[model samples]
Target: MSDTIAFPYPDYLLGEHQFRGDDVRAFFAPGGLFAEGPIPAKEIYDELNASFNGRGGSRIELIREAYDSVTFAAAYGAYISASTKPDDVVILVGHSIGGEKALLASKATLSAEIDLLATIDPVSRITTGFRKPLQDVSVPESVGYFFNRWQQNYPWPVDYGSDGRIAVQDTASTFDDQLKQNDIRNAAGGTKKRGCTAPDYLKGFCKAFSGTTTTTRTDHGKLSHDDWIEQQLRNIIGEKLEARPTIETNYGRSVTEDDAADQVFRWDVRNHVFSWGEQDTPSSVELQVYREGERIPELSGEVSPSGSVDFNQYGLGEYVFSITAHAFNSVTIKQKVIVQDDDSSGPTITLTGPASRRIADSAPLTFRWDATDESSVREVSITATGRHGERLSPGTWASGGAPVSGSFSFDAQPPGNYVLSRSAVDDDRDWDGSGSIDDSSVTSSRSTSFTIYDDDTAKPTIAFFTSDGSPLLDDSHTESHGIANSVSWSVTDDSGIASVDATIYQDDVVIRSVQVGANDRISLDEFGPGDFRVELRAVDADSDGWVGDASERISSVRLTVTNAAPDVFAGGMYLIDEGDLLNLKAVGDDVDPGDADSLRFDWDLGGDGRFDDAQGARPVITWNDLVAHEIDDNGDFVIRVRATDRLGASSTSQATLTVLNSAPALVSIDATPVADENDTVTATGIYEDESPADTHVVTVFWGDGQKSA
Candidate 1:
């Protein structure tokens, strides 16, 4: 047992205990909405203190949620900063919603180096109002290991009444049934209900758990105190303590080496062995090497006393060597070594090409060169200087092997006198032999010159027109009046026309294209009624290497083939008596602004998929006019209306009209003024009916219980 100590604002001290040897610290937090109380946290803290008594000296802190003054995240951060040391073995455990808080705290205090993090039946419902619901929980890189325990069958209740009391019990079926009932209630009242269940937390936990998770059938409220969970915690803590590293102190003399200390070797040297003196013999020796500023151990192992270490595989660089000697006490020695390249011989190159001469601008020119080096040729670079002294880089190429030889070709350079210079470099100056060859005093150079003449630099011009010889403006709209429209274009270039490409696109997608001469015409018969774009590109006969040469041009025009089907806004279920007049208005409009008033409407009151019953925007229909065979089994008739545009594109809408049967009406009944017992009586009834074609029968009843028809 340990004494209870009070902490600052966010951290409330539940209990503290000190073990014997290892420096370890554990942090625990309880679970609840906002984590305002600390009953379960205190229980787990006592168990941990008792379990860690014989293993090592540890400090345990129970962190309570202090959401009043600060958030749970900030409170955990402050507690970590105030209570933890950099070298202590840290363990963190949280239950329920506190598990989420623990994960956040792990990220906040990454420098504390948490060894383990365990969460029990973790839930993240508090932040659901503003943030997205937790889908998966990711383990922070700062934690060495992670453990998660959860229950699946039974979930804790989350929905509360107006008085802030949970509405349902924590049973599996009870919770589910209550949620279903609440959904029905909410649907009837037109309100939304919020709930968090065990499956919600399990789904996220399963996605995040890299290793096997502990799934229990126990309820969420008792999961933290379950026997299996307690045993798992004990086993993990014991293993962590056993694997903890022991503290070591340096108190012996430094080990001395006999090789040239901190020696620098050229890249040409392959092998180097470092040996220690035999006079101060040590029982055992260990070696570790690392690059500067890097903590990764490049090479590490144990060697015999007075033994030599061979570093033949290491490349040219500066490295630190650490050697440890174990005898009466342990001692470590550090030294540095540098490896570099010192070659100074330059490469030799020779250029061969035609002498300075004039050639057509469309002709291609080629130059060849060969370079040789003592060690190895690394790279070759070339540059061209135009007549105006402007420079153009031909890019550098790596040799890939020893001797370098290649050819450079130029295609239709701008009409000018150009000097092409070439350079080559060997691997001599590449210190460390990393292929870092550059232009220096050891680089070889050569040059050649030529002149290009008569280059055309004028783009082509384009113009468009309609079939009527009227200029067709860009981004223009036109109607498809049941006939194809024709468009013409003219293109001219000074160099000469190579080819013209004309393409028609509907809704940004190409529907038709053709290769035509400089002057050509196209028809819009194949295209449908929609917005379209026309693109025309002209290419000149200038043989330049680059695409879209100086004398190439592209033009585009937007064409809207303005004709669309009318949108019909009609369809409903109606009830009416037989022979009753049903007035149905054709409600619709054309999408095209110019075609709205030109729409025509027709009706199909018989449901025969024909629009012959009537014609107009609004039509009065009658049951007697409907075809008897067209009526469905339910005594209902479907009245359809079609709205068509001037171009014949149309849409149809329908409605269901149920014709109900009408009963006969009675006007009055006539009888004798007085009737004697068992005497004959006569009655007459007058009735009116909407269905005048039906025959009627009348029945007369006397008080003596005898009826005649």
Candidate 2:
């Protein structure tokens, strides 16, 4: 049964082909959005073959909406080749939005020499800004906005005092736009009044198996698109007669403006091996591909120290591509088959049941993935400040397995560090990938710590920083502001020391403090604000501790910080004037500019009350009130000279004046009565308000009557 060939575009797509039938092969499928819908066959279940909708807008417009979501399912997976392309094993199952539009139409018509995709739940959903599910803190604010680096720190059941916890808000709900073809028509639950037999079997498999096979997702939880494609095509030819998918995923390493042929994704990995197909017998001791923790760096395959593994690629979202055989020599046989796509409802961990609240800018570390698993995950990582600081991104999700409802998300982290459990593993590496450390289900791989500085940031030296009352200032100014400015900053890190938290942004608003030290000086005077900014946030206090929070660097803050700005600018500005000089500058430059003894001139018109204090520029503008107050006989006047130096560093210098109100006077209009023969008397004008009387630019020397203007 091999006779289809229509593949074109970037060159022979949809699992290309070189058949001979390792176990019945043939690939290619198109028509996910329309091309008539349904040539989407499958030699396997790792169903991936979409072609468009990288996101929603921009990013090349979601890769041109994943290039129209999958250009007829990638022209039926590149003309449905598949007579035998590497043990066949063709996959396409579709769930959430046609399983993420079949690998975005096999990356726009398959050709990377695919093996297994089998997606289930992916969520490139235009951009997944929010499509309903919270009803409370917007469901962890849209699942911590696409899996916030592995649930930040897990342990979230949420209750931060009600109406709280739900960050990641740029805002945008109502199912957030196009959303991967409306979540593959809602993971294929098929409704819209009925008619959705998986979209009429995807329009009868896009007009009777257009090519042969190619699919990104399939179904199970909420899948529809009426699937049965020939007993799932004998389970992709019986797992391609055992197994043998190599590798190739690629995502976070950057998919470039969301290209990779437009993304639909399922591409998660973890062992991904297979056996039979003619030799190399191993029989699946491990081969997972859950996918969804933000899609683990677009996983590829082939790792040593083990058996075989692969992951091709799928970028849009929602995933579950699986094939587990579980331990052979150790005797452990486990088989879990689940392929979905689009809705992207995997990785979740709860426990927010009760705990200190108040989370404004960042906190809600939300949790409760009773077990949510739809697939299309892309990024989740965890913690990992690795090097020796190892924790290698822990947290986790998929617990025991069940719940389901969109990946929720998280944040809080840093505080002291304790968090454990959660679970996602096989993150795929790089930043975290979260794949090992043995999860046996996490009874307590090391959870809950974040007490001190979970992650604020401030350290270079002085892990033992002190500040109970010595920041300086007997009147000297190194550390004196109300007596409670405690600052014991000790942030050690053997493997688990966690925090020292602190922030005193006077007028800024960085406000924080797990312990201000010296018996917690009221938590560092409630995070100070009257001319005191310590911010020595330490971390490594002990949280089963680790902090690859890398973004700002290290678990969170590796800013050994030299915020020590005492090389100069000592702090001194004092002045008070009420009526004498015209524009006596004083608005804002940064700090210094006001000193003389302290300069306090007060002539409240209510004068001399004993409440009158004096500093030093005393009685200096005496030109009879500097020209009787109207001032400026305009010879230019600008006397301003200040300096509080001695370390107080206030500096100002101004000197330029020529006031001669009575020096250039010569009144002689009465001597102009010499109306001799011509009869025309007029000559009286002398001005100097800073020298200005060009009087139409005139020069008249009455000696011979010469006028030039």
Candidate 3:
């Protein structure tokens, strides 16, 4: 607050007044807008003194007062530490060189409380020091940046345009070691990279900043230093703050509680010291109440110290109250609050106690009051004007919750709210029989509402289960082991207990039946078979799916009888001709003389054909066509052996006849007749079999018949 503290951004003011850079404007517009005329921070306001004004802008230094950076830093440190409260935050901003000071004033840049930051383009040099000035490269978490790029071709106003690089932002400067990203390249290349030089690193800052917000806004600026300032403010704050807080920057720079807007409850900021006691005395905290905007009433004990007191009791809009605590300036501390209200305004209508509630006709109801007031003796007499205002019985309102309880009941209709409240009653409610009543509003213990699920109430849910899988088929049998006695039902929307009667039907016969309660239980240790259709009749509420009762279908496992083979035929069979091989030489022709080949008979001859010795006689034999098998040389089928017993009981023992396909033989050779005088000969052979070979036999009768014959 002493000498002429120059701003580092003097050049910004010069450019802003005459020729501003378009890079500064594209931020909102594409060129600079607001006058960046001599943006100094020592005293918080800009002083524009006209210089040599011409088409080519006058050169000036964008500077600030000495110690500005250190002072801003100190102020920020104070604000964040022992001052700010939970659910409260502020955004600090500055343009050009002022922007530099603003950055310096960041306590969060070090302590880590300030959430967001934005700098159009902060000045920097390769040198590393606080005086060299740059964002703290150490902490680059939530910082946002936007470099005012100069338009390569067009200028603003008359010859107005910004294309070439005017200023460079070295975010990697060591001064910003704690608040900005480290630009290692700054150390490596000593200077900016050629083609890629457009403040792009700062562009990343803008992109990161945009993402943190829900709504987005775009702006443009010009070449002049007079670029948009409000847009920058909005970008920095986003939608986080309830209302934007603007710095009072006319001349001298200083923030006070009075500077805070109405939306802000309190504008309290602590220096580097945290948990500092605001006033000399400890904060007054206890059961103390006072009127809005009035001084806090001192508690019987100590009083919590705050700047002011206010509430909406004066009217309704909005009110803000904040306490200036005495924390002894500890780095971290604790605090508490106590509420004491003289809430008294005789039996004022609090609210209707279920004046329009629905109740089931089957259930009874009782009511109570919840109105409050504290002035004279109060009494509330309410009459039961039922759903349609039908006069209800007086005994229904009789009190009985110990001293006073009320009851209302009916048989047919459903439950509903009784119009029980009115502005005026019998007027003489000061005495409850003998004792004077202090309040009039009567509260009720009655039910609020009710609903009918189906016919009159919620139906019971009957669940059918089986040890078998679903899709009951005809062949499927409820296994002797799979039958179950358990069935379940749920009263999905019922006011009463659910009961069930499960009956199982198997083709009209009652296979099993059981009664189940609330949950349900049954055992199927003995049930089985037949087409079962289980019927579950529930007795709780009405059901939608089943017209009569809920149930499921089931079937029993199959019982099949398989024909077992009799001891008749053998396994190894041979094909034979019917007419050629049939009955064995039946004694006296007992067998038929027709069957021979095409028999295909399996003989149990050697019962187990896979043996070397003759098989035991007692065995089964099979025949594809028994009638076609050879009986013997007679072509008959049966082969019987007559046994003459000692007692003369002559019985014929029969053995199964088997046929074998024998390879055919050459039956005979026929020779053709020869002529009597000349030499001529002819010959032929006969063969019959499934497969026969060629015959080779020759005879020649020379026409000299008498000698060669």
Each candidate's root-mean-square deviation in Å?
31.2, 31.9, 23.1
For candidate 3, write residues 1-709 as lDDT tens digits: 1111112233333122321121111111010223334443332223212111132332222222243445544554454443433333433333333344445554244443444443433332222111123434222332333222222221111221222222223454311212221121111111112222234333432233323321121111211122223222332333343232222211123223343242322111111111112333432322222223333333122333322222222221122222222121111111111222222233433333223345434333345444333433234444456556575565544322211222333333334444544222222232222123212323322223333122354354444434442332334433322224232333233435345566766566777777756454444434433344556565654333324322222212222111111122222222345223223221211111111111122232233332222222222223322322212221223333332212222223344443444455567777666545555545666755432222333334544674332
lDDT score at residue 379, model 1, on the 0-100 scale: 70
Task: Output the TM-score of candidate 1.
Answer: 0.29
lDDT of 1 by residue, 129-236 (tens): 111222344455667766665543324533211111112222332211111111211101122222334554664422223353433233445555554344445445
For model 3 the TM-score comes to 0.24
Clashing pairs in 1: 19-57
Question: Each model's C-alpha lDDT?
Answer: 0.58, 0.31, 0.31
Model 1 regions lying over 4 Å from their true place: 1-271, 277-283, 290-299, 312-315, 327-329, 344-403, 408-459, 463-490, 500-539, 546-709
Cα lDDT for residue 623, model 1?
52
Stretches > 4 Å off in candidate 2: 1-23, 26-66, 77-90, 93-99, 103-117, 125-709
Give the alpha carbon lDDT tens digit for every residue of 1-709 in model 2: 1111211111112333333233433333222323231232343212211111121121100111232443545554554342224433444433323334444544443343434333332222233211121222221111111211001111111221222112323334211111122122211122122223453355342232345443333222222232322223223434444443322222222122113234342223332322212123334433234444332333322223233334323222234322222211111111222222223233543444226533221344444333322332223333323223445333433333422323333342444333434444222221112343221211212233232233434232333233543322222233332334454443344433344445554444455544443123323444432444445444333222234432211212111111111111212132212222332322212122222224333211112232122123333443334444334344454344343422333444343444443323333333375787887786766533232321234345666776644
Which runs in model 3 stand beyond 4 Å of their true positions? Answer: 1-561, 569-709
Count: clashes, candidate 2: 187
- Global local distance difference test of model 1: 0.58
Q: Give lDDT: candidate 1, residue 250.
A: 26
